[model samples]
Target: MLHNFTYVLFKLKLIQPSQKAIRFWMDCEDTDKLEFALKHGNYKTRKLAAEALEQIAKPCSIPALLNCINDKVQNVSVACLNALERISPNDELIKTIVRKRFNWVNEIREKRAKYEANKHVKHTIYRWRRTSKESYDRVKEQLKKPIR
Candidate 1:
């Protein structure tokens, strides 16, 4: 079958590191391969894979992108964040995740509760809401100041 042939060719290209594979990872209509590359491939491959996935404009991929937010690499995290921003899902699930992240007043408390709720991760994000509130106040003061 043609699908099997395409699958074989995809696997071969991924193993061989061809430009075609990168392109397929980037621009192909297959979200499955893009998700796989984003999670398991090397940095360059994952970066391009994230970019391509962002361009696909599909809501179904946001959960995978959300998982990428916890990646250790800063660029990878940023790419995933920006991509999720681009996808802009109106679903309650995505909305809840984003709101939980950006909700300044309770962001840290909520994150702490969530992290503590999970005993797997060792480190927790601390002082985020405090620092965020301080930064917000400073920015607000600056905005209120009259330009000379």
Candidate 2:
């Protein structure tokens, strides 16, 4: 069957997972393929899946996107956060994640300014702080729109 063939190709990396996800987005009503890409594919695949989900803005993808916010890769996490903003701006989970990240950024900034931290920790925190601020801004912009 075509499904088995596609899965084999995906597993072999013969076809990019993102491309597969896009194909599924166009051909399927459900997000089974996209969710598979997010869960099993590489970081680039996960990022692309998030982007596709954002474009689709399907409510069904919200839960999967929410889980992606915790992805170990920064790019994947950011993509998921942005997708969540597009899909459900008013969701309490989105609000909580954005607010938490924003507050964490503030705390990092204050700590970095007030105390002398290890060089590695400082570098890591700096990156996280910057990303958190950007994510907060994006979520805030999304929230500004009147709920439909």
Candidate 3:
């Protein structure tokens, strides 16, 4: 209970905790709590939660982490990928699931159009820029290869 409240305080910027402390808080075996935070928390919290999941190495986190692979926050997405790697290393099933979830070609076109249409981009909006294609290609290749 205290940990949950601490997280709320952390979310509100009322308390500044060390990474170790945050990681400790995330050490619970509850995938549901972590999943909720991953889906709803701000980028920093989401990234931290991913790191916690990585430490815990829970297979249950795979779906949530997979969905976050396209997160608008690049670092959060990377953290999710790292967690997924740790939890499901060498799993070909993950690769296929990722491929099914993302249609790179279509998503690229769509994100770009949305970015162009928006005068002020929200934190969650994703648009292709200089490294977008390259990043996508790299992620594709990584997903193709069994996690190393």
lDDT of 1 by residue, 26-121 (tens): 555688877877887667767777877888878788878888776766567667866887798656766666565445425656887887888686
Per residue, candidate 3 scores C-alpha lDDT tens digits across 78-122 of 678778767887898876654544455357768989888995866
Best by lDDT: 2
Model 1: which residue pairs collide?
none
What clash count goes with each model?
0, 0, 0
| Model 3: lDDT of residue 95 | 62
Candidate ranking under lDDT, highest first, comes to: 2, 3, 1
What does candidate 1 score on TM? 0.51
What would the per-residue lDDT of candidate 2 be over residues 1-148, giving only the tens digit for each residue?
Answer: 5655776788687876547545665466447777777877888888887887777788888888878777878678778887888878887878789667646556767887767655446343443358888899999999999999
Q: TM-score winner among the candidates?
A: 2
The pairs that clash in candidate 2 are: none
Q: Of models 2 and 3, which has the larger lDDT?
A: 2
- Models sorted by TM-score, best on top: 2, 3, 1
